[model samples]
Structures are given as C-alpha cells and as structure tokens.
Target chain A: DAPLFDRVAFIGIGLIGSSLARAVAHHNLARSTVCTAKDPEHLEVAHGLKLTTDTAPTIAEAVRDADLVVVCVPVGAYAEVAEQLKGNLKPGVILSDVGSTKTSTVRDLAPILPEGAHLVPGHPIAGTEHSGPAAGFAELFIDRWCILTPPPGTDPAAVEKVAALWRAIGSWIEVMEPEHHDKVLGITSHLPHLIAYTIVGTATDLEEDLKQEVIKFSASGFRDFTRIAASDPVMWRDVFLNNREAVLEIMQRFTEDLTALQRAIRRGEAETLEALFTRTRAIRRAIIDAKQA
Target chain B: DAPLFDRVAFIGIGLIGSSLARAVAHHNLARSTVCTAKDPEHLEVAHGLKLTTDTAPTIAEAVRDADLVVVCVPVGAYAEVAEQLKGNLKPGVILSDVGSTKTSTVRDLAPILPEGAHLVPGHPIAGTEHSGPAAGFAELFIDRWCILTPPPGTDPAAVEKVAALWRAIGSWIEVMEPEHHDKVLGITSHLPHLIAYTIVGTATDLEEDLKQEVIKFSASGFRDFTRIAASDPVMWRDVFLNNREAVLEIMQRFTEDLTALQRAIRRGEAETLEALFTRTRAIRRAIIDAKQA
Candidate 1:
C-alpha cells in the first residue's frame, strides 16, 4: 500500500515529535520524514537515532516541500514558529500539532497559515515525565487518545487524513471543538500537572536537612508527584500561560476543595474527611475499570 | 538464628500490620505471632492467609503473655486501643506501633503503658494504595526506611531488638525524635496524600459527563494522583487528624507556594512558573540518586 503521506515535517523534534517520527517510520506512514529544532543538540540526536529521514536547522528548510507539518514545540513558541512556517508551507499542506493546549494552538497557528493550507490542531494524551528526543519510543502513542480540534467548515478530508496519521501510529482518535478540548484537558491534564508542580515546589522550599530527608523517604507518596513535577518546565509554563482561564477556573475549584479539607482536618472532622476521601476512590476504580489506570 | 521475640501480638492486622506479619514469618523474626482486629472479617482474612500463628477476638486476648505488642490501628483509634491495652501488657513487654504520625503514638500510648514496659513508635515508609490483610506481602518492607521514634530513657535493649526485627526483614533503620519524624513525613508523605485526595475529590465533584472524560484521559497526569487518592480513607483521615499540627504547618507552606504559582499563572508570569518547576526537578534527581524514586 502507498504511504499515508509522501512527506511529513516536524517543526520541533522533542519527546512527542521524536516518538511520532519513530512510529511513523516503524509503520511506514510516510515515505520521507524531516524534522527541525532550534536546539542543535536535539537535531543531532534525532539524526543519530534516525528518527527522521532528513534533519534541518530551520522550519523553512524542513517544511518547504513537505505535505504535512506537525508543530511539536512549547505553546509559547508557537507564534514564532508559525511566522517561520507562514511562507514556507506548500499549498494544500495539512498543518497539525501535538501541543498540550488546543485553543491556543488554533489561536496561535491558524492566523499565520497559508491560504489553501488546512489547520488541524491536535493533542496526544500520552507522554512520560522524561523529555527530550532520546526519551521517545515507537510505542508511545499505543492505546492513547489523540484529540483533534479542527475549526468549523474545515475540510473533512483533511481532518480524516490527520486522523489517519494518528490512527496509523495506534492512537484512538477524538475530534472535538478546540474550546472544549482545552476545558476537558484543563481538568484532566493541566490541573494535575499544576498541583504536582506546586507540591514538589513545596518540597523544594523545605529546610536543607528536611529537604534531603524528603528525597530519602520520597517513596512513601511524594515520589509520584516528583516524577510528574519533573516534566519539561518550559512546556508546562507555556501550558499554564496559554490556557490561563481554564487552568485558573479548575485551580480555583481545587483550592476551595483543599481549603475545606484543611478545615476538616483542623477541626478533627473525621467523618467529613473520610467521606471525601472515600468518594475519591470510586473515580480511581472507574479509571481502572475503564482500562486507563 | 533464633527469633527476635518469643511472641508478637498485633492489635490490628490491616495492610501494614499484615505485611509486617508476613515479613516476620518469612524471616522467622518472631517465634509466635497473634493478631486481632476490630473487624472480624480482617481476622478471618489473616487466618486464611496463615499470616499469624494465632488469631484472637480482642486486644486483651491477643496481647496476653506476648513479648512484643504492636498497635496497628488508625491513629484516631490509638487512644481507645491504649485504654484497652492499659492492663493487658505484660511486664517488660515492648510496645510499638506502625502509625503514620509518631508524636501521637507516644502521646496516646505512653500514658497507658505499665511500668517497666518499653514504647518504640515506628513508621515504615512504604505502602501501595490498597489496604486490608489481602493486600500484604513479605517484600513490602524491603529496602525501605523504618523510622523508630523511641522516647528518651526508653529501654535500649527493646529498641535494639525492634530495629533488629526490621533489619531482618530487609528494612533500613533510622531512629529520630517522634516530633521530627512527624515533621519530615508531613512534607514527604502526608501533604502529598492530602493534595492527591483533594485533586481527585475535585474530579469527583465535576459534572458526570466531564468526570467520565477525565478518567478516560487520566494518563496525561491525573492517573498518578488518583492512585494516591485511592489509599485507605479511614487510615488517612486518622493521619490528618492525629498529625494535625505538622500537617497544617506543611500544608500552610504548600498553600502559600500554590497560591504563588496560581498568581503567576493568572498573571501569565512564565518565568516564575518555569523557575519553580525547574527547581523541583533537582529534588526528583536527588530522589533518584538516593535510590528512593
């Protein structure tokens, strides 16, 4: 069978990008794949690992003739990358992304896209605490959700083709409005990372001796949060900045709930604390039952 | 090669208690072990698993003529258990516990101990989210820290024997003041669990449709918090109530830090968020370096 696309270009080859490249090559989804990153070392790593057929130092060089261009950088850098991509994209190129925040993806990339080029923003709900090109694997997207938020009246054929790319890489496809995607992920992914970052930052601010002891005894429960908190700082920062309203709304609810629990603990309200804690366990069971645990 | 104690009694055989019992049996740490729980089903499960040499109906019966008595109930139940144990402990018997909060262990158990009996409170820094006797295994304590918080002037021989028992079960031992133990754990274990419980509780409060979606996409980061939140509720409620002071202190620090991050996010202060997140990574690296990750 013919490959899904003749050529695919990745604008920033980090964890998700490199992983997608690996999967693309493994599945023969593209006949030729090229990637570019601002960091020379990351490009070198991608080249050494053969994550792409060719590597370029600039997005212009990478996407000049590519049929598909997937932007895989921090949301904060999207605008700049979009500028570089504006004049370089081939007519009828399908532009997609693997960024965390989708509304911002549309807000930043859609304006600069060339006429006749389709914009289909996406987010793959998969990754580990580790980052960088070397941390990628061909199976990274297996059984994970890859959400695409295409603007209204966009070409269905273009969306289907993008969905096919993710499908070829083993992702279950979901198409949603960009705004709803941001809201759902605000609760699922963004808020959780924010809380993990806050708790790990709290541990970091402890006195020197106590800080060392925390690391020594981290396996208790803190270790999990530490792993979540160790995710790319720049990536997370951009996520918060780009998705401020949704993140803040969810965070406010979380803070209020936390405050109520704090008061219950202070008042020795065992039943109240027990009720909330017990109810939360049901969700965990549901997650396990859903095969997402 | 002989057992450390002639007879060991467990006042409540839940997850931690049963795991210790299994480790003791596997290593022959005790010549005879007897357990009793307020819940008869737990006793039945313990018996079915052959976790102890004997099962008794009451604390009085369980502790009779035992050389070592370990209280393994919720921290909130410590005072009631102490009242029941007031006259049951034999002379020169070593009294201990595996409670999360050490200061409360001493405050509750010390007042009721008979003369010449020793008290050594310990907290093993290991456990999964699951609870109950069925969730225990002998390898639970391997390579983990078993912190002992014995009061001043306590019998050195009793402390040495308890440490030996843990050592035999492959635990590394660290002796410290109970207050200090609570403080360190307030940061490392309690706060993390509290945060996890809070965030998962927030998810539980969401609209039904959104809640289901959150679980489906949880692997993005929320799944980790759900696992922590799934931990036994009564045990955690008791932990927060008993360790109120230390937990509140650390939680206050955490809230301030969280609020700062929240403000930064609200203001779109990318640098502030990035700086704190990057600093937290150092702790994760340290935890990995310490072999506790």
Candidate 2:
C-alpha cells in the first residue's frame, strides 16, 4: 500500500512526539519522517533510537517540504516555534499537534498557518509520569482516546487525514470544539494532576523524618498521587498556564467540594462522608464500563 | 510442623479480614480459624467461601477459646466489638487488629483487655478498592508492610507471635508508637483517600452529559482517583471519623498548599508551579528506591 503521507515532520521529539513518530514508522504511515527538538540532547537520542527517518536541527528545516507537520514541543513553546514556521511550511501541509491544551494550540498555530494549510489541533489522552524521547513507545496510544478540535471551516479532508493517522496508530477519535475540549479535560485531566501535584508538594514540606516515612508507607494510597505528581514539570506548568481559565474555574469547584468534605470530617458526619464515597464509586464503574479504566 | 496458633479468631470478614483468613490458611499460620461479623450477610459469605475453618454466630462465640483474636472491623465499631470481647476473651489471649487507625484501636481495645490478656494492636498497610470475602486472596499481603503498635509493656512473646504469623504470611513488620503510626498513616493513607473521594465526588456533581464525558475520558488521570475513591465507603467513613485529628491536620496543610498553587496558577507563576512539581518527583523516586512503588 502507498504511504499515507510523502513526508511527516515533527517539531519536537519529546514523549508524545516520539511516541507518534514511532507509531507512524512502525505502521509505515509515512514514506519519510523527520523530527527536530529544541534540546539537542533529545534530537541526539532520537537519532540513536532511530525514532524517525531523519533529524533536523531547526523547525524551519524540518517542516520545509513536509506534507504533514506535527508541533510536539511543550505548549508554552508553541508561539516561538510557530514564528519559525510562519513562511517555511509547505503550502498545503496539514498542521496538527499532540498537545494537552487544545485552545492554546489553535490560538498559537492558526495565525501562522499559510493560506492553503490546515490546522487540526489534537490532544491524545495518553501519557505516563516518565517524559523525554526515551520514554515514548509505539503502543502508548493503543485503545486510548485522541480528541481533535479543528476550528470551524477547516477542510474535511485535512481533519479526516489527521483522524485516520491516529486511528491507524490505535486510537479512538472524538472531535469537538476547542473550548469544550478544554472544559472536559480541565476537570478530568487538569484538576487531577493539579491535586496530585499539590498533595505531593505538601508532603515535600513535611519534616525530613516524617517525609521519609511517608515514602516508606506510601503504598496505601499516597503512592498513586506521587506517581501522578511526578509527571513532566515543564509540560504540566504549561498545561496549567495555557488552560488557566478552565483549570481555575474547575479548581474553584474542587476547593468548594473539598471544604465541604473537610467540614463533614470535622463534624463527624459519617453519613455524609459515606454517601459521597459511595456515590463516587458509580463513576468508577462507569469508567470501567467505558473501558477507560 | 504445627501451625502458629491453636485457634485464631476474626471479628469481621471483609476485604482485609478475609484476606488474612486466607493467608492464615494458605501459610498454615493457624491450626484453626473462626470468624464472626456484625453483618450476618458477611458471615454467610464467609461461610460460603470457607474463609475460616469455622464461622461463629457472635463475637463471644468466636473468641471463646482462641489464642489470638484479631479485630477486623471498621474503627468506629471497635468500641462495640470491644464491649462484646471484654469478658469473653480467653485469659492471656493476644488481641490484635488490622484497623487503619492505631490510636483508636489502642483507645478502644485497651480498656477491655483483661489484665493477663495482651493488647497488641496491628495495622497491615495493605488493601484494595474491592470489598467482601470474594475480593481477598492469600497473596494480598506479600511484600506489604504489617505495622504492630502494641502499647508499651505488652508481652514481648505475644507481639513476636503476631509478627511471626505476618512474616510467615509474607509481610515485613514494623513496630511503632500508636500515636506515631496514626500520624504517619494520616498523611500517607487517610489524607489521600479523603482527597480522592472529594475529587471524585466533585465529578459526580457535574451535569449528566459532562459527567459521562468525564468518565469516558478518565484514563488521563482521574481514573486513579476513582479507583481509590471506590474503596469501601463504610470502611473509609469510619477511618475519617476515628482518625479525625491527624487527618484533619494533614488535610489543613494540604489545603494551604493547594491554595498557594492555585494562586500561583492564577497569577501565571510558571516557575513556582514547575518548582513544586519537580520537588514532588523526588518523593516518587524515593518511593521507587524504597521498593514501595
């Protein structure tokens, strides 16, 4: 079968970027793939791992003749990278991303897209606490979700091509508005990561002995939070910053709920505590039924 | 070789209780085991599963001639269970438990302990979200910690026997002051559960459509919290009520830390967010080093 694209370009070879590149290469989705990283070390690692057919030192050089361009750096670096690609992209190239925050992606990349290019912003709801080029794998997106939030009026062929690539890589695709994507993920992904980071950070402030004991006895439950909190710091910082409004709004609700729970604990409201705990189990069941657990 | 104890009695047969019963049988840790539960349905399930060699109709009947009595109910029920055990306990019997809060275990069971009887409170740092006899396995405690918080001046031989049984069943043992155990676990276990329950509960309040979306996309991070939050509600309710002081204090610290992070996010203080996130990663590394992760 013919390759899906003549040349696919990756702007940053980090965890998500490298994983997608590996999937494309492993599945023969692209005839040729080239990746460039802001960190030369990452590009070197990519070379050593043969993560792509080629490595470019600069974003412009990488995307020069590419049929599909994937921006894969931290979300905060989007504007700078977009600046370099302003006039370097192929005329009809499909510009997509594997970013966490969809709104920021569209805002930063859309303005620089050439007249004939297409912008199909995507967020693959898959990752691990581990990061960098070495941490990615071809199976990272298997059976997971990939959400595409193309701004209205985007070419159907362009969006379908992006979806087809993700589907070939073992992802279920869902397309929604960029704003709605941020809101849902704000609660599901952003809030959980923020809380995990906060609780683990709190433990960091504990007395040295107590802190060590917390780690020693962490299996009970805290270990889960520590794992989540250990996710890429710069990536997460960009997520919180770029999705600030939605994150803050959802966080407000979380704080209010937490305060209520804290009060219930204080007043010895056993029934209230049990009711909430029991109710939440239904959500777990739903996730299990959805095969998302 | 002879079993570790002549007769071992369990006062409840939930997840932890049934697991211990299975472990006891699997390892020949006890010659004969009998279990009783406040809920007849649980006793019936225990009977159906053959969780113990014998199933007793009441606490008194269960502990009448047992050499070791392990209370395996929620902390809130300790006072009532202790009342039933006050005079019926075999003379010189070693009374232990697998409760979460050690201070409450000591507080509730200490007074009822006969002069010659030993009070050796234990808290096995192991469990899962599932509850009841069907959810237990003999290997649940393997590689897990079993903490013994026997009050000062207790019989050394009794404590050693308890430790020996846990070791035989594949657990590492640690002895600490009850207060210290409660404080450490408050941060490690109790606070984490509370936060998980709170966040999952927060999701439950979202609109029905959005709520379904949250569950569908939960693998991003919320799924871990849901699994933790799905743990037996009555058990966790009792945990929070019994370990009020320690849980509340740690929760206070957690809330303050969360508030600071919230302000940082609101103000776009990317460095502060990244710094805290990076620090928490060290704890995860420490846990991995300790083989607790």
Candidate 3:
C-alpha cells in the first residue's frame, strides 16, 4: 500500500518528536521521515537510535521537500522555529505541532505559515517523566488521546490526514477549538504539573535530615509528585509561559479551594473536610469509568 | 512455632485493620484475633473474608481476654473508641493503634489506658486508595515501614512485643517521638493528600462539559492526584483535623512556595521555573537511589 505522506519532517527530536518518529516507522505511515533539532547532541542521539530516516541541521533543510511538517519543539521556541521556516515550506504542505499548549501554537506559528500551507495543532495526551530522544518508544501513544485544535478555515483534507496519521499510530482523536483545548488541558495537565513541581520544590527546601527522611518515606504520597515534577524543565517552562492566562485561572481556583480546605482544618470542621473529600472521590470514579485511570 | 500473642483485638476492620488481621493470621502472630467496628456491614465483610478468627459486636467484647489490642479506626473516632476500651482493658495488656496522626493518637488514647496497660502507638506507612475490609491482603505490609511512636516512659517490653509482630510480618521498624512523626508525615503524606484533594476539587467545580473532558484527558497528570484524592474521606478528614498544627505548618510552607512559582510564571521567569524543576528532579533521583521510587 502507498504511505500516508511522501515525507514527514519533524522540527525537534526530543521525547515526543522521537516517539512520533518511531510510531511512524513502526506503521509505515510515511514514505520517509526526517528530523532536525537545535541541539546537535539530540540529533546525534536520534540518529544513533535510528529514530528518523534522515537528519537535517536546520528546519529549513528538514522540511524542504516534505508534505507534512510537525513542529515538536517546546511551545516557547515555536516563534523562532517558525521564522526559520517562513518561506521555505513546500506549496500545499500541512503544518502541525505536538506542543502542549494549542492557543500559543496558532498564535506563534499561524502568522509565519506560507501561502497554501495548513495548520493543525495537536497534543498527544501521553508521556512518562523521562525526556530526550533516547527516552521515546513506539507505543507511547497507545490508547491515549490525540487532541487536535485546527483553526477554522483550515483545509478538511489536511485535518483528516493528520488525524489518520495519529490513528495509524494508535491514538484516539478529538477535534476542538484551540482556546477550549488550552483551557481543558490547563486543568488536566498544566496545573497538575505546576502543583507537583511546587510541592516537590517545597520538600526540596526542607532541612537536610528531614529531606532525607522525606525521600525514604515518599511512598506515602510525595513519590508520585516527584515523578510528575521530574518531567522536562524546558518543556514545562514553555507550557507555563505560553499558557499563562488559562494556567493562572485554574491555579486561582485551586488556591481558593486549597484555602477553603485549610480553613476547615484550622476551624476543626471535620464535616466540611469529609464532604469535600467524598465529593472529589466521585471524580476519580468517573475517571475510572472513562477508562482514563 | 507458638503464636506471638495469646489473643489480639482489633477495634476496627477497615482496610488497615483487616490487612493487619490477615498478616497476623498469615504469620501466626496471634493464636486468635477478634475485631469490632461501628458499621455492622464492615464486620460482616471481615467475617466473610476470614480476616479475623472472631467478630465481636462491640469493642468491649472484642478486647475481653485479649492480651494485645490494636485500634485501627479513623483518627476522629479514636476518642470515642478509647471510651469504650477504658476500664475494660486487661491489666498488663499492650495497646497500640494504626492511625496516621501519632500526636493525636497519644493525646486521645493515653488518657483512657488503664494502669499496667502499656500504650505503643504505631503508624504503618502503607495503604491503597481502596478501603473497606475486603480491600485488604496479607502482603500489603511487606517491605513497608511501620513507625512506632511510644510515649515517654512507655514500657520497653511492650514496645518490643509490638515491634516483633511487625518484624515477623516483613516491615522495617522506626521509633520516633510522636511530634516528630507528625511533622515528618505532615510534609510527606498529609500535605500531598491535601494538595491532591484541592486540585481534584477544583476540577470538580468546573462546568459539566469541561469536567467530563478533564476525566477523559486525565492520564496527562491529573489522574495521579485523583487516585490520591480518592482515599478514604473520613480517615483523611480526621488526619487533617487531628494533626492540624503540623498540617497547617507544612501547608503554609507549601502555599508560600507555590505562590512564588505562580509569580515566576506570571513574570515569564523561565530561569526560575526551570531551576526549581531541575532541583526537584534530583530529589526523584535520590528517592530512586534509596530504592523507594
């Protein structure tokens, strides 16, 4: 059978980038896959792992003849990378990204897209705490959600092709507006990461001996936060920076809720605490029922 | 291969209570074990699961003729249960508990203990989100820590007997002052659970459509918090209420740290965010090195 695309170009070769590359290779979704990264070491490691069919030193060279160009770098770098690819994209090429924040995707890349090029921003809601090109695998997207936020007026064929590629790679797809996607993920992913980072950072500031004991006894709960907080710093920094309003909005709600619980604790309002705790358990049940647990 | 105790009495038969009964039966730690709970259904489930040698309708009856008694109910119920055990405890009996808050355990339980009956409060740092008697297994305590916080002037022999039972069941033992245990666990367990409940509660307050979407995309990061927040409500309520001083102290630190991160995000201080995230990763590595990851 003919492949989905003549060639697919990846603009970054880190965990998400390399994982998609592996999935494309495993399913033969594209005739050829090429990747480029600003970091020379990342390109070297991706080549060593054979993550892509070819490697390029620049985004312009990588997307030269490709029909699909997926920008998989951190959201903060989207503007700079888009500048490099402004007029070099092939005619009728589809431009997509695997960035966490979709609003920023359209904000930064949409302006630089050449004539006839379509943009379909996506977020594969899957990953481990590990990073780098060597930390990726073909099965990372299995049974996971691939949310695409293609702007209005985007070519339907372009959206369908991106959906098909993700479907072939083991992802379930949902399409929504970029603004709504950012808000939903702000609660589900970005805020959770921020809270984890904050809590773990709080523990990191504990006195020396107490800090050692915290690590030894982390299985109680702190260990889980540690895993989430250990995710790629550069990527998360970009996520918080680009998705500022949504994150701050959700964070405001979280802080308000936390303060309420703290006040309940202070006033010895056991009923209030128990009621809130029990109410939250229903969400967990709902998540389990949704098979997201 | 004689049993370690003539008879053992459990004041409650929830997750922790039933698991301890199963472990005692597995290791022949006691010749016979009896349990009683306020909820009749819990007693029925414990009996059906064969978790205890006998099920009593009341705490007073359960502790009759038993040489060792372990209170395993929520911390909020400690005072009420202690009232039932008072004046009924056998002379020279060793009394202990599996509650999460040690200072409260000592505070609530010490006053009711009869002369010649020794108190050795312990907190087994192990559990799952699931509760109830049927949710227990004999191996739940394997390779976990069981911390004993015996009050000053507690009988050394009584503490040793309790330590021996835990050792036979494959737990590493640590003895510390009750205040110290509360402070350590406030950071490691209580604060984490509070933060999780807060985050999950924030999601719960969202609009219905967005709430459903949060569940669908939970695998990103929110799922872990859901699991933590799903833990027994009454138990956590008591933990926060009874350990208010320690919990509030640690939560203050956490809130301050979180606010700092929030400001950094608002200001687009990528270096500050990245530095904090990088420092937290070292703690994860330390946890892994300690084999607690």
Question: Clashes per prediction?
Answer: 0, 0, 0
Sort the candidates on lDDT, descending order: 2, 3, 1
Candidate 3 per-residue C-alpha lDDT over A1-293 given as tens digits, one digit per residue, 9 for 90 to 100 = 99999999999988899999999999999999999999898789889999989999989999999999999998999989989999899999999999999999999999988888999999999999998898899999999999999999999999999999999999999999999999999999999999999999999999999999898788889999999999999899999999999999999999999998889899999799989999999999998898888
Candidate 3, superposed: residue stretches over 4 Å from native:
none
Model 3 earns a TM-score of 0.98
By DockQ, the better pick of 1 and 3 is 3
Scored by lDDT, model 2 comes in at 0.93
lDDT of 1 by residue, A1-293 (tens): 99999999998888999999999999999999999999898789889999999999988999998999999999999999988987888999999999999889998998988889899998999999888899999999999999999999889999999999899888999899989988999999999999888888888777888888999999889999989999999999999999999999999999999899999988989899999989999999998998888
Rank candidates, TM-score, best first: 2, 1, 3
Identify the runs in model 2 with alpha carbons over 4 angstroms from their true place: none
TM-score-best of 2 and 3: 2
Measured over all alpha carbons after superposition, the RMSD of each candidate to the real structure, in angstroms, is 1.1, 1.0, 1.2
Can you tell me which runs of candidate 1 are displaced by over 4 Å? Answer: none
- In the range B1-293, model 3's lDDT, one tens digit per residue, is 88999999999988899999999999988888999989898788888888889999999999988999999999999989989998889988999999999999999999988988899999998899999898888898888899999999998999999999999998989999999999999999999999999999999988998999999999999999999999999999989988899999999999999899999999989999989989999999999997777
> Using DockQ as the measure, which candidate wins?
2
DockQ of each: 0.88, 0.92, 0.88
* Weakest lDDT window of 10 consecutive positions for candidate 2 chain A: A37-46
TM-score of each: 0.98, 0.99, 0.98
Fnat for each predicted structure, in order: 0.88, 0.92, 0.90
Docking class of predicted structure 3: high
Q: Residue-wise lDDT of candidate 2 within B186-270, one digit each (tens)? A: 9999999999999999999999999989988998999999999999998999999998999989999999999999999999998
